[model samples]
Target: MPLGILEDNKLEHVPGTAPLNELGRLDLEIGQAIDRNILKHDSTGQIVLVPQPSDSPNDPYNWSRWKKELFTVVIAYGCGCVGAVGPLLTPAFVPLAEQFGVPLQRFTLGCNGSCIVAIAASSIFCNTLAVKIGKRPIYLATTLGLAVSCFWAAEVHSFGSLAGARTLQGFCMAPFEALIPASIADIWFVHERGFRAAIFNLGVLGGINLAGPIAGSVIQYGSYRIAMHGMGGAFVLMLLMVIFLMPESAYHRKGALNIDTGDKVIVTDKLSEASIEKSGVQEVKTSTTSIPSTEPPKSWTQELLPWSGYFDHVSFWRTLLRPFVVIASPVVMWATLLFTTCISWLVLISITLSQIFAAPPYNFSVSSVGATNVSSFVASLIGTLAAGPIIDGVVKMMSKRNRGIFEPEFRLPVMITYIVFTATGFFAWGESLYEQQPWPVPVIVCMGLINLGIQLGTSSVVTYVCDSHREQSAECFAIMNFIKNMFAFGLTFYVNDWILEQGVRNCFFVIGGITIGCALLTIPMYIWGKRARSFVFRYKLLDRVLKAP
Candidate 1:
């Protein structure tokens, strides 16, 4: 028997199961009679591959595992570089403020706040273009722009000039948030994406946390200008990688209709009649013809071409507006709230760290302030490595309990850890700083807990959205990025003020309460999520928007 095929050939139907076509009802189960040849299967035959790969070897899904991993690393590095830029100057906030003859709040508003707004504003346009054209050119163009912006930052004499460069850098960085997740979905299967997405998120958090130390050391020893120049040089190297190493991952899976069989097995393009007969399979339900691609794979040089041909079939205006439509999704809204609250804490903690430690009881040096990020970096690494692989295992174990049927809600149990870690981290962090307990309490232990929660929450939310709304994953992510960044940008206007007014302990107490509330949303989501997906699908909400003028 084939790996995925059960010898008994009995199809078990679980009660209250939503239709297979419902948005979030993904049936990833073992022992399905899906023809392994027609639809891709994992090595264990434990699960049917989502968005089955085409025969053309150029499909990113068909690429060798090592090749996919290498490409992922290159992209992750770019994400890290972008992640680093926003905070590289954070360590020098005080000195930069003094040099520019401005207050810390005003300086942060110009530099960090403006950059976040830019990141929010630019994501929709960049994502639409990426979906319409190709990801390769966007990656190259934005990376090049980001590199130049870094060089510009190094030369800036005025606060205005620095803000301008940072704004440009933010615009370039926007694509990574939306595109990287989409690219991961394109390359990896559902079961494989948990860990892979973790890797990508790790790159981002790693870059962000680690950049603090590098910038601090540089600022302490030399100057912020040197740090800017070093960053520019780093981006230049990333650009070269984009040029020589990265291949276009934006392939249009044209005419691919994911027909959800009762078992939630995808009946891709064409089914094998002979195999179906041999397996004694009956009642195959499909609405579209399944045709395998026979096109020859592109040559190495061809793959290296920066621009793949335009995806003319993708309407630019429609793609641009799609995220707005997708924003209506309950799943997307929950994800935005969960993801925003989770990631914003990282930023909140980051921007405030220098201020808290630089003043009063701690009176830490600039380098010491930046050095504190090492704890976050180490904690993020540990959290990611621990959570990534385990996510897949948890899903598999739960699926087995459900008679091998998979629902996106299976991803939510991990959010419990997110709640515990984040709530505790916030409360502890604030109290530690307020009590002036030692540097290690807030900097090492508390910060570590917060970062750990961030890794868990971020990876789980991204993976969940992609799995739940696979077709609109790009649009969903685009809007989520926009909302989350906007949320962060808005916070900058008042974060410092709020901290001063409310005091660190109270501010964190409120934020910790909010964190718990956000994480608790997972409970309702786990219960009613499938029904909500069904209601949206049945109502044709997305279709109405897509067809509108």
Candidate 2:
């Protein structure tokens, strides 16, 4: 037998956590053939494109390197900008609180709380619609909606009005949160998705870290309303970028790769009938593939149209159920726990920044408070640049050592880096703030370590889940988006009071302990993850609910 081919192709395992020859494990050894017609990299015949591309020119997988890079960049920028909307007014929160005649706690609840809940609620509908119609139209519509909401926020005269505008912004911002991961899966192959996904995460975290400084600068010399106006203008430019630069990534190829068992590659052709035998489920009825279109490549004008053809095969209601069904999977649940814990710290830091810095010992101006985020932004950038390529390289190295068989657990080791940075960062931040150390202490070194951990942790959880649950990555992310933000929202409900009651030093000491506890979860999952995956599949946990009427 060839080095890469399994002695017995198995159908008894889950999608991406199967044994020797299956979805998660790829035959990366040189000179091994998956199929005669499957596409392989020209530079190295060793690796085949998973979910192989069709011969169609419009398949996102077939796009040129430059084109793909451009699209990724635009998408990252848009996601980042939209994400920044959550905290665009963080530095101005106090001034806005004064103007609206409300306590700062109520103000944060109305603005940030509304936005977080809206993002969670909107994920369900936006994901369903994006899958049904296409993501491009949603992107354009949401960008416009976000711009309008920001402008409305600028003009708001009351607390109710501000909250309403923020709710709308949350709705518009939802797609970028839930759909970007799916978009990456749509375009990039497994090998490339780690880096691509990391870029998008960077955009989101970076925008948030940078928004404070930008808003602070505007608010320092101007007013809260002026800061809103500045944000609104930025989104308008983002809308124009989406209009001209972005293209539809959704494509329905003639063939379908069975990600469940990977026992067979089902390549459909009009001239030949193909059938798929799903593991322990009913076999697909034999059918001839639709004839390939001979249409010429789309011009720029044609690409601008909002509608790409529908993915008629996908059911909106069924897709909607997946977010809930995936909750039953232990892998997904663990990912959510890990992600929410890391993200909560980031959110807490953002929420408490102005309060901590603008008060007594520091007595910093809004601009100075905003400038503190520069350290986190720089740290996140370094993590982004390093984590992605290192992950891909690590996976390849581990796979080769295991006879070209890859397991999603290969990604978990990266979490060790996350654990060290986050735990230590929390202790340092707490101590520095407690002692009323100089701004450079907690703001620079401490925050840098914290954000760096966040970056690494975010990339690891996202890439791991996407790789583990390739077919259900979008739904998995939907659940993650909802749960994590909801967790953040819940924290906001009590976080302020809790900090006041416990004091900063004690609160951070507790937070650091919780963070370490959460990071320690990587151990059990790394050891038993494959078993958990198999358990989910063997029992048909998600399948029962997903296939239910």
Candidate 3:
């Protein structure tokens, strides 16, 4: 019955409140065996962790390392497909318009409009359902549905028909937008999530940039329908992956662990001889859950269709509206604002780049126009490699320096990378384009700096938000995607006008100013982040609203 110092603080339950688990509590604690040993200091030689994991065999925290890694890949691929829809068919806009017998303008917003609305709106229903029912069913159903809708896109002959199909496709793809991050929280510890989240973000960027060339090539060589066919084919494959491998990640952690490791077996008196003597009328039972399965249960059926709560006493309608309530959390709101900056700039890049390359003396072809984005993708990779591993290391170091305490804002200092690269790139891109300098100037500046900045900024905001609110993570992510998409959609719709009004130089100067301001805002947040989190938790208003029926 030995207990450690850090363990004591974590297990102390607040009265009339949930236990201090990933979702219920937000605090630093001693690491489990692996987390403590994941890295070590040379000077003081102490162990550090963001939070410890529970020991329940069913807890995703206890899953084998390989299983977690495999799941991350599958989830990232799914996320990639969903994000690809945002710009997937942009390269084929003209051809699609001709085939649909509509104005190119109508086709321009055809899929993009419905896709944005669906992504923003569907997260409410999709994430809520995933939290209550489980992650597996939603993944399978949505992916298959998305696949079907993708194929439908290949055959559509009218703008109205295309929009209708895209709307459904968006709802199906919505899980990748929000729940994929939640799934990471379900399976990973806080120290492990930043790097893992960066992987998912990379996948998202891949989809956004890669889709342009893919669609353009298909249209250039074959037909626009071929592009949809290929996209649909990927979905079909992912749906199969989901069915065969993606199991339920939501674990029902019912009781508190009483041991130091939180990994020891719970002593059940009911199974003991003395308890059996007192209650001879019944068989032994454990309080871990209402339904218990055999030890190391082995079966493909169970793995594919884990846990049965198909008709659980939950409300889908309430879940649909939960994210709106969760948005009230200050951390969620701020993280979203930071996230929106990246999304707005991303839309600006997508929209304004086409305008620049299509109209200028350069007069780049559509294919070349689309291919230019490859630079951004390359920059994203550099940003990914730079931030992925180091972010976790920085967290471990900072947490250890602070006596093994971890705060959400410890992730904020990385914003310097965003400011330096993004600001320089923004200024260079604007000024170079305004002066109508050589193509190399804007391309090189954007690829090397601004894209790098966007990547880092994206990783910073998402990881911080996900880390700060693990308890309500699914709903919080829904809020992030919902609001961010709305802003992105609107930005794309109106940015041409914004650029026209302010001119390119003035336009990006303002964008650079906003980016710098967002980075500076992190300073106060880092200093007072804990107090702000405490302020939210002390009242527990978000919990009440989210859980309210």
Candidate 4:
């Protein structure tokens, strides 16, 4: 008997149940039919069993390009809001210091302290939460939590209150950073992944750049509280957009509910009709029976602690340790550290440049200095648009040359071009400071280059980490973010002091040298990366010992 037919007959015989409503029944029957006939394969038959194609309409990838773009945009914007708010709040330090009766230098610690906590908590919790409640819910909850934190921050009267709010906000916002990448992975195929990631990256950078000008305008007109309130409103709007527009991307098996009977119907048939038809088999109807779903629904506790049983899982520990392991691989470690250094340099430059341009011979007002971020905005947009397509193109070209086999290292060539451009910009900025060149020329040109370097370096390193450690990409990224932000937060505090002591020219010279040094490390890394990988693979002791028995 044909398995599909038999199962359908059994479904029909279930006592006290009416036929399913049109949509529900159609979906069920279609799914069942596809599973039985197309997905199932027979080994005994002369006929070859071809697997079912996932090109069906129900597949998320089969959705219209516009829908995919919309999804990308929403995820990008949500992550952007979460990422930008913390950094933007840095510029309001003066106001915060005055209001809270704290020293400006001491108050800066609040930003650093919050970032430290965020890094620690996110490394521990983001992946677990995403696995627990699913990405959609975590995303929604994080956005709501950030909004509440912002509101509390605005109303707080004490330094302790504001610091607590910022700390909690950091923790709340971590999930957005963690889950968006996973969501992108789930929704997009490999070919389109780079482009989507670029879009997400651009949104994050753009938000950071835009925050300066937005906050500047708000602070110009109103108090720090008002700025916080305004940001809170934006968060609320984002929350609404997410709830209504973002569909759950995680695969969920909803139990079939009988509309007429209000009881669950378990469909257990797993055979296809085409096999039976080809084998000249007869159709037999089996009696309908009720059975529970094959996989039981997870309990509330399980939902809360998705890593419970997995706590003792060796692979989980390995994943947690994988980033550190990769760090021991010289190429991976150097590339990641250089990437972290580049991020820290650019962030420090951005924060310090605002203070520099707004204060001295330039005498640009707070608003105008804030407006200087336009250079970063433009540079980020161009760099992001160009990086992915160019990297993909380079990979394709190299693969064709190598007889169609892809090597992960093909992505390294463009970094050379980026390094050169970055060095030129750094030299130019230093010379301008030394020569005291025109204000706009130095600020705009330097900012544009610095931003370009940041975009290229960040994108390349992230892609490299993913390629090298495909199974543990999340932990690698989490650790990378933690390190990058910690350095950046620390750098922020001392950058002004450095400029004050060393003079702007010497400061720029020092920073430019560091930038060049970081960029040059990439050349050796690209050359020795393979040897490093080989060494890691050969030495199983490090992997096994650190990962546990």
Candidate 5:
């Protein structure tokens, strides 16, 4: 009686069917349990669903496409709004510097300080919490945190308070950053995830891109304090929207196969009863099946929960520490390295964006620098729109060609885009600024490529890592993110010095070289990622450690 058609009780046999293993003729009817089939049919109708959905309508995968897409749009929009708070202050740095009587560059520390909390929240605590409590709760709590932090940003009197507010805002941001990809895995089939993730990547990074312009206009009309007020107000509306619109994405469906064996496509679901007890649940409930069903067609009000059932059966400590165990995996390591390198370049640009454009041959006002990012915003949006579905379509094509077999590597060829555009963008942006060429060249063309590259890389790697460890996606993401934040957070502290000492031309050239080198790791991953995963799974303590028995 759940959404799709259920399997019939009786098995129908064909006419002239031979019994007792006596059939010599080919009557190849491998129609095994149609009800269980999560048929994500492609043009080449070799029916498959990666990891597959359960028979329950309560399963997120079974939700109506409208609900899933609506949730995604909200996620993209909310994440974009919240993330903008991070760098909106870039255009306002001069005003902030003057307000606090500090050097202009000192504000970079305030921006970077969020990296510290982001490391803790995203890499470990908040991401781990999302697995237990569910993403809706974390979303509400984090949105509230962003709201309060923004108001604090407006009122903060000293550099310390400003840094504290920014850091807290970053803390609020980490859960959204680390959780969205893993959460998308909840409702979307693997083939559909690329474009959806593009939406997410756009919101978070695009928010950062769009913020400069917003900050410029805000600062142009009023004070930097006004920008914080506006950002805070925006988050408040986002909070209300989430409370009404965002339903739970975390579903406790049993995996069809063991991820450790590499026997099937990896899919992570919330903890099962056996795993829950193993993870450390003291008392068991009669319905150890799942959290409250968002199914059965509830009233408008009943769809929302006062709070999610966080850690009722799952172990928080085990989930918190799981990232460390995952890092031991070479596949996860390479993905982490790729993400870190990509993020480093983005951060380098954000910290110095206003500084570069505000004072130079251009002599642009705060608003102009902000407007420069508009092209990046549009380009990245279009790129994500095009890139996501294109990759999804490619996966279907390749899967059909492979006789309906899907490999994680099917996504890697797409990352070739990352290598080409990301490398070129970094070199051109830096070189143009270094040479003082026509300003629009770097602002539009060069920066647009980097934005596109970053979005593409993000969608690919998140899919790669999440698909590989879907059985324990929280741990997988936490581990990859742990390393990613570590690299990005560490760089944030002293990137300014590195830029000042090296000069922008040499600085970007070096960073570009590093990214190109790291991007090549995708080669081995595409070719031998399964073997690498198998090697890690062989360790005696890997399960007990990472899965946390």
Candidate 6:
């Protein structure tokens, strides 16, 4: 018998009637070897492994253009409703206070307290949950929950019930803040992320600011119950859009099956082939490989806790303790602090504007104060539209000059011009209030500039952090959100009291000074950002950089 011969569709030894001597055996082996060499084939053939493409049509990216746009719209709208609606409720403070037999300050606490909870919990849990269950479902669940809570709030008679409903609303809404960005990141590539994020940010800002007008209209034409009902309706529409149009972005979808044995293999769908090809464009075939687990798989309880892994990782604890480490990195710290201060100041202006317009000089009603938020909505739109492409262009230009190295600091140039405009706007606003200037002047100059500053500061800071800590952008952003909301929460509570005590003139002066100071800090950060990054990398303090989801 010769082992090399093919038989019955399988490789087999050739069988003869009898055993052979050494020379006979050698001859048979040679014959069999020749036959095997000429007729060789893989037992499984070519395997026909038509892997689901990375940018497969089935993937979120490869979805129809309408679908992507719809997803963007849904996310933006959902997030906008969550962020804006609650803050706008501030206008109803007096009524709420009277109804609950509580002080205005206590009413403010309900709103502000919810914001604090959102900031604290969102940063901790959003990324972890998105990584666990997935983004779309979380987005859907939270949005619907928010709507239900809104309805519950409308029906509540007691302060405790209202507060509890609002808290639940805030917690559910937290996912919108966290998941929208994650969703954007899932579908958009690095080059396109800025533009898409700009759209998302605009929705968030627009929705929040627009809430005033929307709420105002509801108050004037309808009851609080009516207003909440309308908000709930809007959320329901947003929910429907998500359920129908928002496909799972390829980044989150589980791996597809192996063609041969139908076993699953881990491979991320490629963005180009996955998203682009769905648009009827041709793309290259990509080889697939299994994804390696970087962190250990989590149990249900571990998954629920936002800071689960960190409890065990000493470095994580160290990282938590040294949030200022971001500040120490001239770029991260400076940008974060600058934007944080800028946002705080912008919020101050908004708070101040509301009081000024609604009180003595203007004598506008609560509804009017809420309606004035329309100015911010407009400014946010303009700022967001301008920011995306311009920021991307600046980064691209600088990256080219730097031999394709990208630094987060490239986004600062635009901030310079914005700061000037913002400062001028603040001064103009203060002067307008002092002189009791006509309505249009403050609206155009003061309100416009405040919002412009907000857009510039927010956009710049978000993009900077994402760029600075590529891997940990989600966590970094979570931390940034935590800091921002904490600042905002405190300011919202007291800015009114400050205005009452110091008078508008001193308050505006103080705000302007703070903004100018924060804007100045940008210079050192912009200058030293790259050098700082290099230093961090060299020292292997890169671990200190926030990791993305």
Tell me each candidate's TM-score: 0.90, 0.89, 0.83, 0.73, 0.84, 0.72
Model 6 C-alpha lDDT per residue in residues 1-549, reported as the tens digit of each score: 011111121212111111111211232422322221211112342111122223233444444567577778777777688767666566566665786898766677675566556655665565555544456556667778877988887788888887887777777766666556656655553444566767767877787788877786677567677777778888888777667656554243334321111111111234222422232422222332323223333333433332322222234444453343444455555655765676556555544544577677787776887777788788888888888778777765654454333345666676775677777777777778878888888876677877776676667766665555543455455555667667877876777788788777777777777777788876766665555555554454535433321
Model 2: residues with Cα > 4 Å off, grouped in runs: 1-14, 17-39, 256-296, 313-315, 547-549
Please report how far candidate 4 places residue 372 from its true position, in Å. 1.2
Residue 319, candidate 1: C-alpha displacement in angstroms: 1.7
Q: Identify the candidate with maximal lDDT.
A: 1
User: Over the full model, what C-alpha lDDT does candidate 4 score relative to the true structure?
Assistant: 0.59
Question: Which one is best on TM-score?
Answer: 1
Off by over 4 Å in 6: 1-67, 250-331, 346-354, 400-405, 539-549
- Which window of ten consecutive residues has the lowest lDDT sum in model 5? 14-23
RMSD each, Å: 5.4, 4.8, 7.4, 13.4, 9.2, 17.0
**How do the residues 1-549 of candidate 5 rate in per-residue lDDT, one tens digit apiece?**
001112122223211111111123121221222221223333344444554455466667777888888889888889799668767877656656777888766666765656444645565788777767777888898889999998998987788888888878878877777777887887887777788878888898889889988888988888778998999999999998888878877866553322223322222245333422332422323344234434464455766884644343547787666777777777678888887777656766877776777776887887887788887788778778887677777766665554444556667778888989889999998899889999888898899988888888878887777666665666677666666666666766677677778878898898889988999878767766655555555553357755554
Give candidate 4's error at residue 538 in angstroms: 4.8
Tens digit of lDDT per residue, candidate 1, span 1-549?
111212222324221131212123233432244422334466765465655565566778788888788888887898889889988888778877999999999998899998998998788989888877888888989999998999999999999999999999999999877788988888887778888888888888999999999999999999899999999999999998888778888786543435332233433333433223333653332321344567788888887887978474657788789889987878888999998898888888778877888898988888998999999999889988977667777776766565555667777788987988879999999898889898999988998999898898888898888877776788888899899999999888889889989899999999999999989998888776766566556566676765455
| Models sorted by TM-score, best on top | 1, 2, 5, 3, 4, 6
Pairs of residues clashing in candidate 5: 267-470, 267-471, 268-470, 268-471
Worst 10 residues of 1 by lDDT: 14-23
Which candidate model has the greater TM-score, 2 or 3?
Answer: 2
Say which prediction, candidate 3 or candidate 6, comes out ahead on TM-score: 3
lDDT score for candidate 6 against the true structure = 0.58
lDDT value, residue 531 of candidate 5: 57
Model 3, 1-549: lDDT tens digits are 001111222223211111112322123233221122322122244432223344356667667788789888887788778767667777555556676787544554666767777878787788877877887888888888988998898888777878998889878878887888888877876667778878788788877877776666667778767778888999988888787767678765433222121122121222132322224332323332123333363355767764445343447776676788778777787788888787668766765655667676778766766676777778877878877776777766665555545556667778888889998888888898889998877876665688788777778777787677766788888888888878776765666667767888988988888888877887767665655565565677576766565
Pairs of residues clashing in candidate 4: 36-271, 36-272, 37-272
